[model samples]
Target: MNKQPGTSGLIFNEPLLWDKSREGRCAVSLPKPDVERADLEKDLIGDAPELPQLSELDVVRHYTRLSQWNFGVDSGMYPLGSCTMKYNPKTNEVQAARQGFAGAHPFAGEEFSQGALKLMYNLEQYLAKLTGFDAVTLQPAAGAHGELAGMLMIHAYHAKMGKQRSKIIIPDTAHGTNPASASLCGYDSINIKSGDNGILEPLAVAAVMDEETAGIMVTNPNTLGLFESNIKEIADIVHSKGGLVYGDGANMNAIMGIVKPGEIGVDVLHFNLHKTFSTPHGGGGPGSGPVAVGKTLEPFLPVPRIVKELDSYKLVTDFSDTMGRLHTFYGHFGVMIRAYAYILSMGGKGLTDASKLAVLNANYVKESLKGTLNLPYDYPCMHECVFNDEFQKEYHITTMDMAKRLLDYGFHPPTVYFPLVVDSAFMVEPTETESKEDIDQFISAVKAIAKEAQENPEKLKKAPHKTKVTRLDEVAAARKPCLRG
Candidate 1:
């Protein structure tokens, strides 16, 4: 109805650095070596590698143009559904870049790096208090890593009781990583389907939970965007059968200060600092997933754990039942610093408000777009909502087509065909960061695309008409990747 944000405008056409390379071009003037050059042995030498030569201006303009084509949460609203791609505050970055935190060497003695140690010590306490767990280990590098640590601890718990369990219970509504994490720990995943209402039913969990099962891995405010209301009962069932409960805290963004997993009978849980704690999320390197556990599993946490004795902080590794090391250093220290900054900045009340606003924003989008999109579950959702192409199916327009078309509207697409249970699922999570106006624009774009599906179905088929790089052959790209050196 209105001029969409994705409408095409002036764009610069640029070429690769190699294509622009010339014989006499040089971006830098290197100084002559002061030391004498020594010849290496023939065995140690290799053929010279080909490299591009370009002017300083050429290199600067090339990268600057490339940056203009990129989009991020800072550039626009990122309703990336289950991912929680919310705005990461710049304050977190500032705190992380501080000299003491950033320059601390991992191999430095505890006495030399007391500031970093103190930060880690206090961060562990903050996380434990937030999640209502007895103790914590900031070793695991990511959510899946945290899950493995949790399962290993669960495995250790059962083994300590003189019997090693063989299986783990995972609900269909749980994160996709749950099964893989369980498998890595040598536990056969007993997958159970969620109830028709889109949440795990206590009866279904009771049927699969047994002494042979190590525990249950559940993603609360599950992938379908519905909360698992029967979690307490399910936890009770698992505990009664001599199994522990492993809560996948990926969706903790939706209930930060409101619900503590430990109080809900979860024995162990992990916090995704990137997802829930305002740390930069994508591009993969800087992620921190600190696992928190109850008294039963605390003894088996990862080694080199931070502790305080009298007036000083220390990293000790003498725990006999520990799960050994999970990272090269004490996890990603920069990510920990960012998360610690976020937690301290938000405090208790701010975190509660964030959860409340996240739920509110998601429901707002759900209610606004349900008329045009087919909502698989009509009930109240937590931090995200799942829609599908049922309404556009008659037009032969699919989820991928609509997602591509959203790019034309100047918005990053919400996750599509996920949570696996719903057919042609289009999951949307508008985190607490977006404004009402921005969300309305997103809703308008989706509704406009739905209208185009009926009026001009072919347009949706050849979608993303305005982007520099249009629709790609994603399947071929994944299967037959072209890696260039």
Candidate 2:
């Protein structure tokens, strides 16, 4: 089937590279082998590899066209709540691609990697100061990885105190990774329900805190986009019971310089640098989620922390009660470089402005859609807003249908059916990076969709008429995934 361009002339139905290859076609020229004749491994080697051959232009156009087909934060506004899909700065990209950082070997000696080491060291310090933590670890590779590292450290801290606490208090508003991290550390996740106002209440947490409890895993400005204002009292309750609090810093984008988790009584927290620090996200790989802690959990940090020693910087693996290494190298160095560059570029006041603007933008969008949709929480949201399929459900409309219809309007859908406490949830997070004009356009599109949902219900049911492919049978696709032809 012939497919129309989605954006920037992304031609579809392009032939496979191998399908265009002729037997003798070649894209690159190679010199004759310099090895001795006796070096040929005829006795052990198998058949020669079957490689595709094409002209250099053909190779370039093929990948470039494919990249055009893919949507990214740069391509348009992505309002995915709890994900913080902000525009990654071009300046940060330039910094990350610097020859000094991009070309460094992970296995090279510390003397040869002083600049990279120094960057990492300074980054650790910046994160520590920003989050109000005593120290920070850039070991964990991503947000979930950081969660696992933090949970294990929590387990270790309790174990060192001669207690076998095994239950972790996870609120319903948490990202799914929270309980998974707790379970991975051999702790049972005791799910707690948030209050009717969509924020975690101090009384609800007090009812669950006990001797066997490890701690609470709470996300500030939670999935509902409402801040847990009673965090300090909640933390005190957990601490009074000899437990620790683990803050999931996924929503750190909402509270950058405005609030620090460490000062709010969190013993341990992990920062999603990929989200808050303008690094590339959405792809499965290349993310950084550095964990920071107060003095209590500092001893259990990952091994080989980059430290400064007089004139030179070096790695020190001297922690006696460390959680060991989380990655082979010092996490994703390129990602860290992007994050560090973001910090240096933004500085302290700039970051605070980012948080303020993020909150302002979200409230602006929320006000634009309030009462038109189901405002379940109905309060000021920090960096995102949550709505349910209230009025739309009367017409048999669902969050999924609304999401699919958004594609036709040239807007990516907000996260749907998430933070399960909200019924038929639809969450939107307009990060600080979005301009007021772009936000107004998004608000207009969503309003139009709501109007269309009431007037012509069938349109949403069969949405995305302009894309390369129409609505997909997601259930069938999931149940019978085609791994290969």
Candidate 3:
């Protein structure tokens, strides 16, 4: 299988569309005269825009080739850890793109867009039931936004009780956004070290809990791919200190139906619908992150929550002690619709089965590569596996070198040097949708890379030799970004 050249790879060889422009050639010829605007803002208009001039064929072929050069989950196995880039069902896309749902304006009258409102209302209810929470707010745009919303709710809860909790406890193995969100909410973030087994222990959490502790943000089945086995105990300690528990639900794909965060004493949680509920993640603007809160924290949830009253659905604008609106409208409605479709398609049993298969696939990869790689933690991983570069370092190869080499094998590299706790970390997540043959291909690729590292050290150093673009000077690229054509 040959790899497609990405945009970065095409920069050197591909001709710039602007460079192909001709003075008089145009894709379409326009009419000479049209209606003139009597009242227009002249200051806001530019004199002459430097527009590209190309034939229809040139314009069409350029983008078509570029599209073919891109890689996605549909094209191959995307083993991006913590991303859960599984195959998104086309049925969900079809449903979301339906005219009834997609074409409805956000400000349309409630009576005119009853179906969209109904879907949002029902999706909130379904998420609340799924996570065992009292209320759900589908206002945040993405996981990080959801974290901010959760932290704000925590702040509001503390303020309502006349408490001055000023610190948030986070595990060292958690996502980078955890501490950033806590800091954004004006709370001091306290870092707790993971136990020897790669899980957050209650003892470690207890040592950090105090009267000023705002809450603890933990990712179950943490970035290390191991479940926090002592989560219940950790929650107890925080709750005893009169603080709330915020579950970073980014890894919810591993235990969606198997475990509910609210049942384990979590007061608030956020769902990365783009990750766990099968929404297209990249290109940024369209992700949805809904927050679910238990009873104690429900009162402070973000306002403009959907409500069902007397068989009619409507958006509620006012609520006592609400945390206020995080977004302008009811969040990403199209993403929420896709998520609703995904939940309905999976149901309860299917969700549990998917989680089980995800765990099984991760464990299979871990066992297969145990001898070829260095496993930092000797435990069963849930949805992903973590390995370090200790084995490859013997051959003078680093994790970044190995990752770059994998790009030449027609596959996306696993996340490298993440979780910050492990040395030269390489995290791979073969999502549940991959077949055994695909997993075998990945394993074979890694083994072959290891062999190449031992046989020819220089080859790995100048890696991605077969790729259209070789390894870049990352530091230089960052310091001097060439933005203009």
Candidate No. with top TM-score:
1
The lDDT per prediction is 0.90, 0.87, 0.87
RMSD in Å for model 3: 2.9
> Best by lDDT, which number?
1
Q: Compared with the true structure, what per-residue lDDT tens digits does model 1 show for residues 293-323?
A: 9998999999988989997998899999987
> What lDDT tens digits, residue by residue, belong to model 3 across residues 1-485?
32232223443245788988888778887786578747556677846578988998888887877776667888787898888888889999999999998899987878898898888888889898888898899899999999999999999999999976889999998889989999998999899899899999888888889999998999888999999988898989998989899999998889988898889988899989998888876766578889999889888888887788889988787889998988987788889989999999999988888899899999999999989999999799999999988998878999999899887776788889987889889999998898888888888888888899899989899988766668999999899988773
Candidate 1, pairs of clashing residues: 6-408, 6-409, 6-410
The sequence of per-residue lDDT tens digits that candidate 2 reaches over residues 1-485 is 12211333344655788787777767788888797556558668877777888887888888887776677788888999889899988999999899999899987899799999999999999999999999999989999999999999998899889987979999999988888899999999898898988888899899989999999998887888999999999999999999999998888888899898899899999989889998878878679989999999999999988878897999999989997888887888898999888998888999999999999999998998896778898899999999978999888888888888777767788999887888888999999999888888777777777888899999878987767778999999999997742
- lDDT leaderboard ranking: 1, 2, 3
Q: Is candidate 1 or candidate 2 better by lDDT?
A: 1
- Each candidate structure's TM-score, on Cα atoms with residue i matched to residue i, is 0.95, 0.94, 0.94
Worst 10 residues of 1 by lDDT: 1-10
TM-score of 1: 0.95
- Candidate 2 structure lDDT: 0.87
